[model samples]
Target: MKKTILGLWLLACLSLNALAENIYPISREMGSGTRSAFVDIFEIYKSVNNKKIDAIAQKIEITNSTGIMLTSVANSKNSIGYISLGALNNSIKPISINGVIPSVENITNKSYTIFRNFNVVTKLSNPLIEDFLAYTVSLEAKPIIQKAGYISVSKGNFKSKNPRGKLIIAGSSSVTPLMEKLKESYVKINPNADIEISQSDSTIGVNSVIEGIADIGMVSREVKESELKKGVKPQVLAIDGLAIIVNHQNPITNLTKEQVRKIFLGEITTWEQIQ
Candidate 1:
């Protein structure tokens, strides 16, 4: 009878250990293009049957920065989150959705539907800003953007002369990493220009441009119609993708699009449910 009791206690301990592991769903905060694009591609709101937005609003963690999202997921063995594909590295494991792995070729060929534009917004009247915009979309910036894990929008022969003035670039944290890389390259060539960057979300970026606080706003998604009415002009610079990532220790991978949507909707609650 003592042996039987010992066996039962051991079994209970194992069961308790298993039950202790909970799945964590991490999400980007509102005004994030990464979040917006992710929601649109997954049809998350629609998938919940026009259900309460709380289906998404109630994520286990809400991050305003992509770096935070990366850290949050990387630290938790059961945490899952999404981030710009350009920012993806070995710190976390990117999972395949609907059997599609996020990659440049997949996005370019339209096989991966999780892509969005990196846009720069400025007033339509500034020639200097226009010149900078031209530089961003030109052949000169293509290799730079490609090496940063993004695809430039188009190839053009235009060359931009450095405008020797102070300029501020702010917006979407999703675009900030790649933009920082581009800024490093741009500043090296244009030593006379003083440029500053901010890594807030997209809405604030648009507002900054409208309020005249920022010379240019770096947004990861298209400008909103309301912002267009406010006289903000957005120019597409490059195309980027968002990757759904989990801790490298997580055993489950290769979720279907439906499964991911459902997971965020709170319909699928535990690691056990997914397994």
Candidate 2:
């Protein structure tokens, strides 16, 4: 009889704890460009409000091998999840981080305050990594990074100086064009520097960097605060515009910020009423 009573008490306690805890699985890497940006804002939440996050929420059960699997698990009404602002495809909704939604305008203006630039991170010890890092800081890669959904760090003369060895680069698809451009431009000046580029999404890229799979990782979004322990460096590449695109057939050319908010909030549906 005592065991039964104890079991019930334990179950009640577990249920209550579940209700209070919110789990968020963030990438594991410190200074990862994407995760760092996200974590910075998450830290603010922890600072202002005494909210705790469980990084390993639950051992999510998965059968399919796809990124959508994570999104599906995260989208459960019982859970709050986050994905790259560029990759948000209606599967999961981002919860408000300090009362601001992650949007292009808000991120650019620093109003949303959580968005970060996708970076090109490489080891400081490697001469090749140093060279590539220097190359990325150039003016040429700026436009490419902006197109991929990130803010660039403005520095002058990226490729003028060459570091001594082989260069290996990795990360998001969004950053591929810029990396390719960097490689092509650098090889022309230093014909002996061996350079290779690999592609992965933000989560996978960060994981690779943590595991030492590549010299650098490219991420499309900001990193979460929990991921900052992994020693990755996030550098801003360019400012990207996240536009709310509509079908060309629609006559609407411009939408006031309030109207756009209303549409997303389900307050307005009809196109006729928008005019």
Candidate 3:
């Protein structure tokens, strides 16, 4: 009789814990180009006395890279986050925005609007850098880009001059996978070329190029005006969207743009509120 009473009390506590589950909004740390693009597309900015400022909740979970974003959302049953569509995998579920599902065809046809450009920034020009950058945007790279789940937006040509030099690429984790594929092909053509990729957020990539620390910067968002002013030239490599992902346990599949905007803006605080 005492054992039965203890089991019932434990069950009651479990039920209460489930009932108290609330939505956890996860965001990337500052200086992430992905965060900038998501915030801009979702209109998460607020005008306070005519001065615009970011309005993401002050206490939300913040991650440093795309991989971490996926891990955080996948680990938490109530967490919601965003990542590059190309980097998306089976670990988490991507909820459709509005009625449009995120797919390569949908993104290509303009049905999926929450997308950003994958750019490579270069502050100085050289033979190896020029060849590598051209190869990334050329028609030859399309198959690799497509295979990696990103949309190709360029059809330029690449001819192997067999340029030999060491080059460093630093930037967005979203673009690193595609870049690695391209690096393999480029190195085969020019065996003497050594390519190194250091993955981080987009802002760091662009800044690394501008500061002369890296030869190429992988920026997932459009090149900023300030960065352009600083003389880092951008070349579009591919196009990708930010996928709204949640833990696989979350049953809610589709969210309207308004609901998403509100959630990110901190207006909607609980899972029950959205349901």
* Per-residue C-alpha lDDT of model 1 across residues 228-258, encoded as one tens digit per residue: 9999888887999889999987766688888
Tell me which residue pairs clash in candidate 1: none
Taken over the whole model, the C-alpha lDDT of each candidate is 0.81, 0.52, 0.88
The parts of candidate 1 lying over 4 Å away from their true place are 1-20, 46-55
lDDT of 2 by residue, 92-137 (tens): 4444444455566677777765444555554344666666676667
Better of 1 and 2 by TM-score: 1
TM-score of model 1 relative to the true fold? 0.87
- Least lDDT summed over 10 consecutive residues: which range in candidate 1? 46-55
Evaluated with lDDT, which candidate comes out highest?
3
Backbone clashes counted, model 1: 0
Error of 3 at 26 (Å): 0.6
- The segments of candidate 2 whose C-alpha lies over 4 angstroms from its true place after superposition are 1-116, 139-152, 158-165, 256-275
- lDDT score at residue 139, model 3, on the 0-100 scale: 84
Tally clashing residue pairs in candidate 3. 0
